[model samples]
Structures are given as structure tokens and as C-alpha cells.
Target chain A: MILSDLVERFGHHPLGIGQEIGRMVTTPGLDNPPLNITEKELTRGLRYVAVEAPSGIRGRMGVLGPLVEQAEAAIVVKNADYAFGCSGCARANIQLIYMLRRKKIPTLEIEYPKTREEAKVMVKRVVDFLRGLGGTNG
Target chain B: MARIAQISCGTEWSGIQDLLEKAANMVGAELFFPEVDLESIDKAVEEVGVNAQSPNLRLMTARAKAVVDGAPAEAVLLLTCFRCAEGVITKHAIRRYLQEKTKIPLVMYSFTEKPKLGELLIRLEALVTLAEKKALLARERQEGITLGIDSGSSTTKAVVMMDNEIIGTGWTPTTTVLDSAEKVKREALEQAKLNGRDIEGIGVTGYGRFLLKEKMSVDLVQEELTVVSKGTAFLANRQRGEAMVIDIGGLDNKVMTLLNGVPDNFTMGGVCAGSSGRFLELAAARLGVDVPTLGKLALRGDPERVKMDSYCAIFGIQDLVSGLASGVSKEDVAAAACRSVARQVFETQLQEIDLRQPIIEVGGTSLVDGLVKEMGEILNADIVVPRFPQFGGAVGAALLVSGVV
Candidate 1:
């Protein structure tokens, strides 16, 4: 929520599974749900995730991969636990963060806050990074 | 035999030709690759308005040229390797180019060096459906009394008709698939002043089609791909030419390219609801307005006044909330929401095909003036919304089931 607010505050779009839950609902006549993107998108995602990874990994990569591809910049909050949600999509999230870093877009990774002071510091870091994105005034 | 065009550069080196031929044999289609002079690839690429260093990508324009210029081929098969990112982009360019340039049935695949039959069979079978069913697909009129029911993901719709004229339509938000179907069927029949026995036949289609099939004792059970096109054509009075149908539904969205009302090439699904009608619904609830009111508000507002960039409905809502809290008028937020959905659909779904004119926009979302207006502005073409657009799947079922007699 903090990240979404900061990005929107800075007039930038946020890319994350939480931001894209609508992808979970399958389109009419689509062959597969959750993973049912256009065939072209499916092909694009095929190269990113290891074939041997869990389907949860593939499914996560399937929807989130394209967003990662188009992401001009990204923010990662590492050491997040199950409370982070989407029922154990953490593995794919890990892979995607690595991808964003590799893409060499301006990126910032902050540890999940463990205390109130840490939470304040985390918010400052996010705000500072977002301000650096050179964006439109939303 | 159906003549199929084999368009690719690396098929010989990949050792996948046998699998392609075998799959075509399984579907009884004869495969033929269209060839142009080796030196013409550069000129063809320029003519097609796409540039790529891959000779294979350049060569794609040649095949597109031959197929569009009245080649004898009845279907097109496009292949490229999965490992090449350039191949995928060029392949899509070719697909879109072919869609605009010709009406021939086209299916594309990104293959591994050694492809298996299982990977290619279903796609080849779709080509067979188009080839063998051309006569039935070309039918422009419904012939008998029939009831069609579409048990869709978000709603159930029923259409009652007699001899090419629609008598009634029924719709309700979906709960239990079987119950919704039964309710709509009952409503349509009553409106038509008929009993179940008065209707000659019943047809079913949609996401919940199969569950309602045996219980409803349906006569024709077809998928949405064929059914929706038939409905769009019948309603739009364009059943005998090249027509395009864009159905932006509650949960997902679809774009179908058709010739004489038969779907030749199409793509459906959404990676984000920001592209689907559900986003509008969410925006409506947030704005304290109904979906219809939201559309009117969007027309009155200016998209330029709002600073919103939404790729996902969930995040789009965040932007909506922030704007609302910041004293942005509901109208601007609504316009922004509509534009966001339209842009998302264009970037994700519309980019997959080069649209044909006289585009018919159907499904529940078609009712939204705002969404349709935004889409039209982006595509720079007027869209036609047929009467009872939400009943596309049901109307299609009703139209085809008439042939069962």
C-alpha cells in the first residue's frame, strides 16, 4: 500500500501481482486461467522462468513477466514473509526482482521493516527513490 | 484437400518439418510453403512496413504477399523458434500484417528445434474447422424456432427467436450456472409467449456451457469463437463479408477476425482486468455511480486534466482513490478510468490483430459509451454496437441451432 501510494503520488505506474489481480480471472474462450495471457505473451514468458521450476513459478512469471519486461524502473521489498500474500508466489517474486535488477532500470531494494522506526526509514527510502524517477506531475 | 501455407525460415534446420506435415496429415490438409525470390525479402519487408535483420523475419513479408494476393492456400501456418525474441516480435508483426492483408485462416507457433506432434495438432485442427465448415459458417440467416443460452462467467443470457427474427432476450448476473441458464431460458420463452415445447430446439455456449448442456438437453453445443461471431454478424447486418467483432466482457476481453461471419483468426484473454469491463464496475462503485452514469461522466470530463497511468485494475483503483481524495472531480476520474481501460485493451489485446473496418463491439461492456468512445478515439474508427449486444453468445447459439433442424 505504501509503495502504491508513493508511485501514484509521484504519478508513476506500479507493477506487481497485487496491482494486477484481474489477471487471475480468465477471459472468455481463453484456454487457461491465471496463466491465460495472449499466446504471444505466453511465448515471451517461456524464456524467463526455468522449465524445471514449480508451476507456481511459471504461473507467476506468466502474468508478471510481461509487466517486468515493460517496467522502466522497479522497487523491491525483500525478506517479505507469507504475510506478503498471494499464497506463496514468493519464489517467482524472487526471480522477477532478479530480472528487474538485471534489466538495469534504476532499482531500489529495501528490507521489510521489523520496527516502527524501520518502517519510517523504509518509507523515506521509497519516497526518495520514486522522486528520482523523473516523471510527469500526477 | 485444404491447401496450407508453411511460412518459416528454420523449419528445415530444426527437423520439425515431419512433425508439421504429420500434423497436417492428421487433419487432412496439404501443406505448401509460398516462396518469393531470395532477393525480394528486403523489398517485401519495406512494403510491409517492418524492419528486422533476421532474413527469416524479412522473408515473412514474402509469404504474406503471396497469401494476400490470392494464393490458392486455404489456411496459413506461421512458425518461428521460441528462443529468438526477435522472432516472436517479427512473427506478431507478420500475423498482424497477414490479418489486415488477407482473410485466410492463420495460426502461428514458436517451435523448439525438435517439435512434437502434440504441440501442433490442436492448432492444425482449428484450421480444419475453418476449411471443412465454410458452408455452414457462411450461412447468413436463421431458419427455425430456437432458444439459445449462454452461461457466461459474469452473466447468463438467453435469446428466443423464430425464423431469422429475434423474439426475446434474457440476462442476469451469474450465480449458479445451471440456475442462471434456467432462469434466462424461462424469461426469454415467456417473453416470446411460448412454452419449452413451443421452442423447436435449445442451444448452449459460453464458459459454463457444458454444465448446462446435459441438464438443459441442448441440441447444438458450440464454443464462443464461432457462436459470438455469428451473433455479431447477424445483429450488425454484416453476415456476408469481412467483419471484425470485439467483445469486451466482464472478466475477459476478445477480438475475432471473421470472413462472412466465420472466425478466421482471433485472440482472447487479459493479463489485467484494467482491460476488461470489471474495471469499469469497480470504478463505478468507487465513484458512487452506476456503470452507465460513469460513462456519461467520462464524456463530460477531460482525460488530460487527470494524471493517471494504470496498467492493472487494482492499481488503477489506487489512482482513482488518490484522485478522489485529492478533490479531483468524479468526471475526470471516470474519464481517466475509461481511458486507462481502453489503453490497456489496445496495448494488450488490440495490438495482436490489425482490425478490419465495420468493427462490431459487443458484450456487456459495449453498453458503456465511455469505454467505446475511448476505444474509437484510439483506433480512430467508429464501432457498431448491435441490438442486445450482451446476448452475443446466446444469439450465436440460437442462430446455429436453427441449422440442427
Candidate 2:
């Protein structure tokens, strides 16, 4: 939400993997829901990852591909909330960052703020980065 | 006994009351705050025949009417936030209605995120001066020549007032405050064909007022806000109407409300270059255009095509560079930059005040054609840029020492 607010504040659109996937699935279009992945492959992940890995790391790239293609920039927030013994989320996080960096788009990675001061610093950093993309400060 | 009514957002009332009191005391007036509860607000809206959905606006409208009806105050002061959408939407109607009903003076002052103590004091002093019906400076029976010097950050302005008229005015780039003050003063004196000994008194204002005062013996050292308000009010009164004065300086911006030939309330921008003259200069430099030519270039561009998002000077430059790299025209980028500055002023600095027509734009930035155009479009009002806009503060200072304001 903070990332979205910052992106919107700077007059840029904030595209997320879940939102893109949701749109693809709900909207009528020639484009595939997961971009490069087949329906069969998605089923295999649902069956295999749900029972075996449970993290869905194998299908991470396919899901994130559309998000990266649509994004002008990316913000990755690594927090303990997602660190609760989920290997799939961890792997997907690293994969998403790698894919975003490969796209050469501006990216900001920071830990979730715990204290009020930390939150201020974190928000400032994000605001600065987003504003820097425009080549100015507010 | 002099009594003044203050109406403000309930949230800011506590924080600003002490400062308001101090200002009222300066002019020998007592401050009276109206009860700003929902019931009174509802009653006021009903009485004024206006429907207001926003609680803040309703409260302010109600309070203004309540003060005018209940308290026999000399004037009314309304404090509001620049970012309040509701306040901006309803302020004009409220002011007009209150004035018609009460037949008393009304002034509305808006603030950005944070309000500076010094700026607030200057505004309050102006209000108090109006409420108490006291002249800023005592007038002498015999008229003589008086010099007013405004040593600003970017420029020095001096005006020569002889027998109640501005006989001559001079301005030059400011270097050292003392040197610039002396140079401009000498230039004005030369133009007026008068000697230094002919000057009976000198009033100084602006960022370099103290420095100039230290170098030369001056009669009055007034605040920039005070003098600028006095000057704009004097000009507007000559035209015979109320006006909102916007002064965009090199580093700061000031907004003053003039009612009945007096500055009743005012506001100043924060320490950000986003809305200052420096931002326009920086944007122009980055665009490889002269500062004076930037406005013309912007005027040629499509106002709808270019949209600058960031309000920061540095970020605006980046946006311009990126736009150029992405195949955006120079004209569009320049236009977008001008729009962004205007947006910052209207949406951030002057957001809370309901803008009326015939806006008196003063200061060096007022000379920017694109900025003035964009401001008119954004505010949907007629902008009146006075001749010698940069000399407003200096002229006001002269008027101050001459006992005209």
C-alpha cells in the first residue's frame, strides 16, 4: 500500500503481480493469463507445488513476467510477515527482484519499518527514489 | 475597546491561538474566538443559505457568521489549511455572505503543512493593525522625502517617496545587502534629483533588512510580510476592491488577503524550492533555455500533453530529462514544468483559501509568462500583475514609513 501510494503520488502507475494476474484472468483478451505459461503448466504447479514444495517457486517466473513487463519501476519490501517459514515466498521474492533488475527499471529494496523513525526514513527513501526517477525532489 | 474575531479549523485552533493572541496584543486589540461546533455550523449554513458537506467548511462558515452576528468585532480572521479541498470550494461564498450580512471586514489566511512563527506573526500583526484601526507608522504633519529599501535575496529594490507620491524607483541584482541598498537608494535619489540629506526617513524590509539597517541608520525595520501586504493592499485599494496578493520570491512565497484597504490575513510558503523562483531558473537551465524565454516556450507547448508529477526542483529536472529522452518535445516539457509549479502553488501553498478574481501577483516570479498563465487557468481567475512587481515590498516599506499603511 505504501509503495502504491508513493508511486501514485509521483504520478506513476504501480503494477503488482497479483493485480495483473487478476486482470488477465477476469478480462477477455487474446493475451494469456500468465503470459508465457500454459494452463496445463499452471495445473501441474497447483498439484505439485501445493503438495510437494508448497512455495510455488517453480511457477514464480511465469507469474511475475507480466508484472515486470508492465512496471516502470519496482519496490520490494522484505519483512518478517513473509519470512514465516515460506521457502516459496523467499524464492519468489529473489526471482522477482532479479527479473526487475534485468529489465533495467529503477528498483528499491528495503525492510519493513518497525519504529516511527524507521518508517519516516523508509518513506523518505522511497519518495526520494520515486521522485528521482522524474529527476527532482518535492 | 478593539475586538477581533478569529475563525479556524478546530484541529489548528489550539496550536495557533497563542500566536494569534500575541498579534492582537501588538495592535492593542483583544482576540475573540467563535464557538466552532457542529450545531453552530449547521445554523450558520442555514442562515447563509449555503449547503456545505465538509465539516471544516461548515464550521468555518458557521463561525464567521456567528462572530459577525454575535460579536461586535472590528474584523474577522479565518485560518485554514491550503490542502483543504472543502475550504477552497466554500470560502468565497462564505466571505461574500458574511460581508453582506455583517458589514465587517474579513480576511482568510491559509497555511501549508507547517506554519512558521515569524510569518504568522507578520500576518497577525497586519490583522491587528486593521482591527485596531491604527496606522502602521505615525504620520507627521509636514511631508518630506522618505526612502524605502527592500534588500531581497535575489534583488535590491529602492523607492523614493516625496510628498506622498513615488517619485522614483530603482532595482538591481543584490550582492552584499549593504552595498545593494546604498546603490539602489542612490539610483532612486539620482532619478528624483534629490540629495541624501533631503531624505527625512528610511524604511527597510526583506531578508536583508537587518543587514542594511546595520550598515545605514534607518528609521523603521519592518518585516517583509508587513510591507508587502501594505504595498499590495495600497495598490488594490487604488483600484477599489478586495484582492488576494501572491508574492513569489527567490526562495519563498507569500499570500495575503486585502480587505477594505488593509491586509487582514496572510500566509508564507515553506523552505522548499518547489514553488520558488529558484525552481523555475533551475528548470529553465536544464531545458537549455533562458529563464525569460522559458515562459514563452511553455506557452507554445500543449498544456494537455505535458504533465509533470513531481513538485521537487531536482525531480522536475529529472522528469524533463526523461521526457526529452522518451521523445517528448521541449515545448511540452517546459509547459509541463510550468504547470507543475502552478499546481504546487495552488494545491499546496494556496490550497485552503477560496481564490477570487483579480488576483494580484507580485514578486520576480510574477514576470514569468507561463507561470502567470498557468496560475490563471488553474485558479480560474483573472491575474493582475502590477507594474514593477518586484518593487512591491519596497514600495510598501516606503508607505509604511510614510504612514500610509
Candidate 3:
């Protein structure tokens, strides 16, 4: 959940906290999921998820499709957990981050805080980013 | 009367089912492949209650359990590929759980994409022999001791056996095949407290088996694969019914499938040192630690700290350095390196093979605790490290000449 309260406190709309695009893709007949997905949706999803390289499985791209479509701006927090057993999740997150960058949307990518000092830096960076996006609080 | 139920990856099952059934018939055993449906998987998952990270592995574990529980087989065989990291990690848990639940022996074999059919046939024959007999071949004590030598790329090992028991074993780093063979022989002789003239025959095997045979005038010379399969089967003894043999040497890695008491199919690593003992040595050197201590240091680190994807030695080192620079702990880096090598072995060497339970790991690299743990975790099965793991090749070589005059 990326700073939804903080972004809202600054008077800009924050997409729902803890919202995942994967849920929309997996669940059929969702109202806000990627629209007009056809039989070749699996292949189209792979085109976005496998932007860096061809992956063996494209099932993960279903999550990325709706996520990319729904987001106006994105904040990606990484390194909070290791990607040992969850390479698919990491790959999806990375693909989404890359897609946001390519779309030229206001994007912020930050590493998870490892120390108290780093935590302060993270908050400051988020606050600055929100203000730059025309938030009133800063 | 030994009925065996074999569970393999769906893809691998299609390729070797006929050959496997033929081998089973040859051994006087009936082999059955249980249907691994979603219902069985769900039931297994509910019973196990442990969440395996990979859905494929979760399903496999569940299916294996369901088969053992429902099938009329006396033993279970699990076939796994190298690319399935989840299988390696959960192999032990599955084996123990199933054995406790079903009271049946379980065997696992990891295979490569292209396995040697000849070697597979030999192993299958051995497994059938073991299953039929339910014990290793019994031999009366013979006069004079035989020396067995395994001349590998990185280490030379020698074993001296008297009256079907190992009297002494010795190993040292390889300089030349002949020199290392002689050095190990001398050490074994000294340990056995026997004179040089007491040695009646010398058997040789390994990558330099031919060289050692030519240099030392050996009495019996067998292929390294044959000796290793024999040695693992011998060491496992009755446990051979459910045992899978994995030998990770300096330059090569071998995986053998045992059904009942026989070795059925086997696979070996390619020319790359990416998954061999040399890879660990280099990674340890880069970390300023010895290879033997790599496992201990890794156990001390959090296994979930960082996962490295690269299996190439060069790329692995680069990943290690990058991980360290990124503030990953030293122990975690060490663990990641070990894990990476283990993963590489599974991906490159054992990708197409079926892995089963009670895996027996031998060879010089088996001495490392971290590698074993990593492999065990990846396979999720019981790992058996026999006494003198590194001497298995030598012991098998020696056994060939045990009854010889």
C-alpha cells in the first residue's frame, strides 16, 4: 500500500490502497479489469509482461494488463522481500514499473527502507513527489 | 511380488513410460502410474498443510501422496526434472511423510534432458535386482585385499576392502591421475596397516579411470558411471529400494535412479563446471572462505534473504558482488551462491528427469553442508549422505575386484 493517506492528505486522488491488478485479471467479469480482452489476451498480456525478455509462462501478464490500464501514476516499492520463491511476483512488479515508465506517466520507484535514516529519506521522497504532482500539502 | 508406483512429471512420463514398464517387468515387478488429478492434488494439499511456494510442486507433492495412499504399490518412485527447484526442496518432507503414512519405501531420481539409455537400463536392472532380493548380494570373505581407485578431475579417492568390508579409504587433490591414484593407495594401505604386497588387485574408475588403469596396470577397469551406480546401490543396501543417487564431483554431476534395489536410469552434467564442485570452490574463494565452510556459513544466514537466479559461475560471481554491494549480508550472499549453484545443477543437468524420494548424495561436493541443505530444500525430500560419500566410486571400483584372485 503506497502512501494512500498521504497522497489524499495532499488533496490529490490516490488509487485504492492495497489494490492489485492481478485480482482483476484472474476474476472474470470484473467491472474495472482490462476491457475487450479476447482469446489472444494471453499473448497480448505477454507482450507487456515480457517487455525485457521472453518468459516461459505468460499467465502472470493477466495481472499486469489491468494494472497498466488502470493506473494514472505509479509508485513502486521493491526489495522489501527477497524474490527467492516468488520470481513471478517480482517479474510482474518489474514489468508493471517498466510499463509505467514507457507510458510516460509520473512514476516513482523506491527501495524499501532498511534503516531509520533511510525510512526518513523514503517519506521525504514520497512527500516531495506528491507535491511535485501538484499536491497542496507540501 | 514388489509392486511399484512411479510418479513423474507429466511431460517426462510420456517419454519413458514404456522403457520404465519394461524394466519393471524384467525385475518381476509391476509398475503403475497413478492419475494425478486436481482432486488428488487438493486432497494432498489439505493433508500436508504446508504451503509450497510453487503451484506445480504443490500439485506434484499432493499427487505423489495421493498415489502412495491409494495405489497398491509396495514402493513409490518419484521422477523429477532439474528445473523444478520446488521438488528438490520438498523431497525430504514428502519422503518422510509418505513413509510414515504408508510404510512404503520411496525412491527418487533427477534426470537431465538427454539421459543415457544404456546407463538407465543398467540402473533399472540393479533396482529390480534389489527389489527382488530385498538385500545386497551376500558374499563370503575372500583372501587378500583389493584396492579401488577413483581418479576424478579434482580429487583422487582410494578404498581398500577386505572380506566385503571397507578397511581403509583415502582421498587427496588431483595432480595427475597416476600420482593421485598412487598417493591415495599409499594412504589407504597405511591406514589399513597392510603391506603393498598384500594388495592382490586394483580396480579403477572415474574421468581418469582409463589413464589410471594404463598407468597402474589395474586388474579391472569400469566406466565411471557403472562404478558410481554400483557403489551407490551397494552403499544404500536395502534402502536402495527407495534411493536416488546424486554424485557431485569437481567437474561433473551424476544422478542415478534406483527402483527397488537396482539402478534404472541415470543422467550426468555436461562440460560446464557451473554446477560442479569447482563452482563452489571458486565462489568460496571469492567470498574469502573455504568451500567446506560455505554450507555452515550459509545455514547461519537467512535462507530467504536473497535469491540469486544466475547459475553460470561467472554470472554467479557477478551476482554475488552486486548483492553484497546492495547491502545483502555476507552469510546471505554465501547462501545465495550455494543456492544458485544447486539451482543451476537442477536446471541444466536434471531438468528432464524424474526425481524421487530418499536421495543419496555422494562425491566430493556432497561434503559441503550448504549445498546439501540447498538441494534438500529444492527437492523437498530426505537426503542420505553415506559414510565416506566421496569414496563411493572407489568403493564400487574396489567391489568389482573383491572376489578376484
Candidate 4:
């Protein structure tokens, strides 16, 4: 069974889940296996997908690891949490851009929503980014 | 038949190495007491086995247990009790572990007191008899006689029992703990009219046990608390539950907690004659009076009130002299000294733990009527003083010898 499945079955509270996960990872044995999934493993499972993120340093770094291991198009998702230019999320978005650029993967970035209409527009950008990757799944 | 081992650390007189040798001398029993880390103990046991390849050995805390030729044995753990200020043994745990692991009859002797050479020989005889099949059976069926001795800083005491009728008790001033101990032991035996040969087993308790061990010899040496707790529990005829046992001595103070019929947490102060029985002695010297009469004089105060803040024995005396010049009644001054001692003891014991009611105060110091009365008021609780608080430790030691039966 997956590590997340085990955590879900046993972890009833948020602190409990966090404590269990911390202990599980810290134990001497049972660290590797079907539980440790990589970007290449995700590529084999997914035919069409969008890696959405906010534009910044963190975003650019986030996609770098996955793009280096597997070719995939990226789409940055934005919500009101990033309003007024979030420095933390922006750093993550910048990492994702650097990752796709280094690996020659197709990518796109979009602004987060200010209203309900803007949120719909952000979803459409993610769909269009996946279509440009020569994918089929909406 | 399961094999057993008993590894002892030291004798009442000797250190760790000598104790190891004593354990090694047992017939058909394996013995191991390590000088260093326990990782080497398992290997040492194998090399010294009956067939030179026996694999039944278990290394435990401060001692070892093992099986030799399908027989079980154990080692004793000796520790000092912080509260009662005596050395005691965790003997039963060692015995039970050996019995459970190797399925052999296991026992242990915790060294606490020094016994005379004659007493040591009797204990050795008891051990051999315990291991021997027929003698062990007979001793168990008949119930053996055990004696206890408590050598204090100021006095030496002995408690004797045939099977537990409180046969006789002995007490004498301890010039040197070991020397006084020898005299007390002789006196107790004389009182009981039992020769060393008639004694089944002997246990020693108190701080002076080591000094006595160096002089003479004994079987088991254990802490004062185990001896005192058992004895006090028996005398009181009820389990002393979470109650603070205050032992106010001539030169020092001791406080112990009897939690769930066991003496667990406790504390002790060094030689401070001012806040103990010594305070009364000093007061008696200053007034040119005796100790017993000092208490009654303290009760005869017309004012019935004197305040002496200094707890230092010498400084408090100076304060008392100043108060006397200032027209403080001698009775009130005496009462003030009592209050000083009581306050010091309470600050040391009651400040930390919740002292359960009905505190049992022991020691010759407790005989002071004014002290006991003032302490009762200060504590706002009932204080129970035994008939003879001075002999409590010796009585406790004697009670220890007969407990397991």
C-alpha cells in the first residue's frame, strides 16, 4: 500500500497525521519502494496534465526537478493568496520556469484571480496549456 | 532442573572485586560481577561454566543471573535510600528474575551493615543451607530467625526476633559506629539469649553499615528505609500511605515519603546540630539544665511566646541570650528553639511535595514536648510520635529480617 494510504487510514487528526508521517520518514527501515514516486513514475501514469503555479522564484524552482526527469508542459495557477505579488510563491514559480526551460519543456504562466470571473479565466489558461503539449485529457 | 547464577558486587566490608569472589565460591552456581561495561559479561559467563560451554547467563543491573548445568542463580543489587539515609537491597527482583529466567530457586543478599566475624559465618552457613535441598526445605518449613542492626551517627541499636514476637531490643551510644555496633549486636543477642549459631539470617541497615562491615561481617546489608518502613508499618499496624516520615536526629534531619506502603522519595541534610536534637542539647548547656527537663520548663512560660528567627544553632543561641537579657522568659526561649527546628524541617520537606496528614515523627528529638506541640500547630496537622522514637531505625532494621517470611 501507498504511504499516503497508510497515513490516511491511521491518521485521524491533523497533528496525529503530521506526527505519524514524521515518525515514518525518520524510522531506520521502510524508506524506499512503491511509496517513493518520482516524476518519471508520474509521466507513465498521466497522459495529459497541467502543472499550474504562481510566477516567482519558488514557482520556477518547483517545476525544475520534474522537467529534468520527464518532459511535461507547465501552467501556473493563481489565486487571491498571491495578491500584491507574493514573494514566497513567486520564488517557487521562478524555479518551475527555470526547470521547464532547462529541460526544453513547453510552459506557460498565468495571473491569479481577483474575482469569480477571473478564476474561470485562470482555469481556461491551464486547459489551453495542456492542449499545446499535444495532449488529449481535458 | 533450571540453572541459576548469583553475582554479588561487594561484601559488607570489601568493594566490588571481593563481592565477585564471594559469589564465585557458591557450589554449582555461576557468578559474574563486571568491573566495566556489560557487553563483556555474556562472554565471561560462558568461559566459567560447568561444561565450559554453558550458554545460560543473563547480565542484569549491578549483578548477573545465569544457568549452570540446568540450575538457576542470581546477584543482589545494593543501593542507599536517600530519605531514610540507609543502604538497602533490591533483593527480591534479583531472585525473581533468576527464578523466572532459569527456573531455579534464586536469592540475593544486600550488604548494608558490618557484622562480627561470628555473624558472617552464620550468614554463610545460611546461604549454604538455602542451596542444599534438605536443609533449605527444613528452614522454609520452620521459618528462620533473622536479626537487624541500625548503626546511626550518634548511637548504635540492635533488633532481634525469633520469628517476630519483638523478642528484645538494644541501644547504646556510638563512639565509633563499628565498635558500638559490635557492642549493640552482642547486647541484642544477649537479651534474646540466642547464640550466633541459632540465628538463621542477618541483615544490616543505616549509614554506618559500611564501617561495621569493615570491622566484622554480616549476610545482607540494605538501606534504612526498607528496614524502617517495614518496621514502622508493622508497629503502626497500618500501611503508611503517602505520609511523610520525619526523622529528627541529634545532629541531622531526615524526611521520607511512605508512598503506597513503600519508602520512595526522601531527602536528608548534613550534620547541623542547631536545628535538631543538638539544639536542645546546646540550649540545655546554656541554661545549665538537662535535656528532658528543658521541655517541661519550656511549657511553664507565663508569656508562652518568644520569637527566635535565626535557625543557625550557634547564632540562635546568641539570639536566645539577647532575648534572655531583654526579659524573654526561659520557657518561651525554649519554645522558640523548638519552633525554629520545626520550621527548618518543614521548609526542607513540605515545600516540595504534598505531605499527607498524620505525619509520623521519630527520633529522640521528637520527645521534646514543646517541639512536638509547636510543630503540630505550625503544620496544622496531626503528628504521631511513637512510644520510643529513638529506637525506630533499629526497630525497622529488625523488622526487615522477618518481612519476606
Per candidate, the number of residue pairs that clash is 0, 12, 46, 50
Per-prediction DockQ comes to 0.02, 0.01, 0.02, 0.01
Cα shift from native, residue B335, model 4 (Å): 1.2
Looking at chain B only, the TM-scores across the models are 0.79, 0.75, 0.66, 0.62
Docking quality tier of model 4: incorrect
Docking class of predicted structure 1:
incorrect
Q: How displaced is residue B340 in candidate 1, in Å? A: 1.0
lDDT of 1 by residue, B1-405 (tens): 788898876887788888889889986888997867787777677566545566776777687777777778888888877555445545665776787777678876667776656447656765766766676666778887999998888899999999899998899999999999989989998899988898888888887876887777889766677789899999898878788899988888878888778888876653357888889999999999999899999998877666675658888788888888888899998998898888777756664565798889999989888988998987789989888899888988898888776
Residues B259-374 of candidate 3 have per-residue lDDT tens digits of 65345445666656788888888878877889988878887776466655467878867777787787888788778877877776765555334576778898988888888999
User: B1-405, model 2: which lDDT tens digit per residue?
Assistant: 467677766435446566667766764667677765666777777665445466666777777777766766777776666544344335545665666677565565665545666566555555555555345523322147788888888889999987767788889888988888889999999999998998888889988886877889888777776578667655444324567888988887887666544554566676668888888888898888876688888888875665465789888778777887888787887788778788677644564344555688988888888889898887778888877687888877887776532
lDDT of 4 by residue, B241-330 (tens): 556677787777766666544444344555567668888888877777877777777766532355565778888878777778888777
User: What is the alpha-carbon interface RMSD for each candidate?
Assistant: 12.1, 25.7, 12.7, 33.2
Return the DockQ of model 1.
0.02
TM-scores, one per candidate: 0.62, 0.60, 0.53, 0.48
Cα RMSD (angstroms) for every candidate in the order listed: 16.4, 17.9, 16.1, 22.0
lDDT ranking of the models: 1, 2, 3, 4
RMSD to native, candidate 2: 17.9
C-alpha lDDT of residue B251 in model 2: 80
